[model samples]
Target: MSRQVKGVVSMRKGAPVELRTVVVPDPGPGEVTVDVKACGVCHTDFHYREGGINDDFPFLLGHEAAGVVAEVGPGVSNVAPGDYVVLNWRAVCGLCRACRRGRPWYCFDTANATQKMTLEDGTELSPALGIGAFLETTLVAAGQCTKVDPAAPPEVAGLLGCGVMAGLGAATNTGEVGRGDSVAVIGCGGVGGAAIAGARLAGAARIIAVDLDDRKLELATTLGATHTVNSGRTDAVTAIQELTGGFGADVVIDAVGRPETWKQAFYARDLAGTVVLVGVPTPEMTLEIPLLDVFGRGGKLKSSWYGDCLPERDFPMLIDLYLQGRLPLETFVSEKIALTDVEAAFEAMKRGDVLRSVVML
Candidate 1:
């Protein structure tokens, strides 16, 4: 049977989201219905509101979420009702070419609900990142729900579903930050801060954080940054190089994802060091650099798609680490807001007042 649930929706471009009664259908085969417990407000959700992601109107706009399984469709054996889960945007399909090659993180065909969640008028809504959890309840492919320890608070664990995972994976998976390595992360927002934490977890000898905001830099320090650089008042590249004995860092991550920040990351790394881009950029942005510079750098320049994370493998492990009091997952939850306060959260996000304003359902 189809059920009615309240959800935050972006009806059109530049319009504020509405809490409307969305009709969520019962899960079909290989799908499940989740009772969303907590969902975080992320920049990507705001991007959907401003039409930056695409012209997918009436989008259900939250994806960084954790919840409990309420119902499971026939043939769904991966999860059962009452299981706590972290929703993942990437639900790897085993038969994809990428999966065939044993790299499911880059799986070309990820999973989503075959049926659509709709409005009272039957207008289909695009679930943000295909695992929308802005609603009281949501439907997703069974593979999209990764079960984890239920003892972890929903707000903290849900962050691992998106931004936190992106930053953490960017350092551990893409940047390959290792013990004794010097790593620098630019942009000290949730993603960058988590990158700093990830570098620390990976045993980075020196973790330098670069950001324009002094407040964010302060937060970065608490999250394990050994050094902080306020780029607004100094040359970040030079500052990083000087801090790392004039040789630059072993791995530099560009979490701001702009041409200028990308350039700084490119120039702020040691010879043959890796540069990872974890930030999301708009479609119209263009990058220009000397052709020889790319070759002369002689290091890897890569982009992280969902931090190259495999949800099933990473979520439970992160939750375990959080339970062990090692990951400090609670640091990411800036504030808890009601579902109606999503608009206000967006404003706070714009002013850089909060890392994540989560909605507790």
Candidate 2:
């Protein structure tokens, strides 16, 4: 039987999302249905609303979520009904070349529900990140649901599904930020802040946070930054260099993803130091840098996809840390909202007012 539930959907480009009846079909083979407890409003959801992601109209726009398995289809054994799980976009297929190489984090074949969720009129809807979580119930590939510690609150645990995981992974996994190293993170948004926290967890000797907004820089400090640089008022590269005793940081993370920020990250690192780019850039933007500089940098320049996260490993470890008070995941939940408030939450994100405004379903 099909289920009708309320969901936040983007019907057209640049239009506000509307709460409408979303039709979810019963799970098919290897699929599971989630009873969404909480879903966070992320900038990617806003991008989908603006048609920045694609022409996939009527997108079901929430991905960062924590929920329980309400039902499972035939042949599904990864999770069962009543199990608490954190939804992940990357449902790795073990047979993929990337997985075959023992790097499942770079899984070339991720999974999603084979069937589509739609409207009453039968218009097929694209789920954001292949896990449309803003609805009361959503269907996904069984592998997308990774069971985590049930003791943590949904509002906090759900963030590991995306931004938070991205930042932490950029630093810990992609950048290889190490103990006693000097690290600087450009752009103190949710992802950047998480990078700072990750650096702290890695025992970085110094952590510098750069941001255009003072409020964001201040918040970054609470996460683990040793120093804050207001790029709006200072030359970011020079400031970072000065803070690092003129040697530059050992690792610099470009969480902003803009060309200028990337340039700063490229120049603000020591020779052979890593520069991690975790931010999502638009297709129209072009990066033009001197070829000689790239050769001279002589270090790893990498991009982090989903923070190079293996959901089964990272999510559980992070949830355990959060429960133990070692990781302060609570700071990321700026507000709790209803499904209808997603459009407004987008505005708050645009204005840099909230890290996340999660929908409690």
Score each candidate by Cα lDDT: 0.95, 0.93
Across 109-190, the per-residue lDDT of candidate 2 in tens digits comes to: 9999999999989999999999999999999999999999899989999999999999999999888888999999999989
Stretches of candidate 2 off by over 4 Å are none
CA lDDT for candidate 2: 0.93
lDDT of 1 by residue, 191-249 (tens): 99999999999999999999999999999999999999999999999999999999999
Model 2's TM-score against the true structure: 0.99
- Name model 1 segments beyond 4 Å from true: none
Model 1, position 190: C-alpha lDDT score:
93
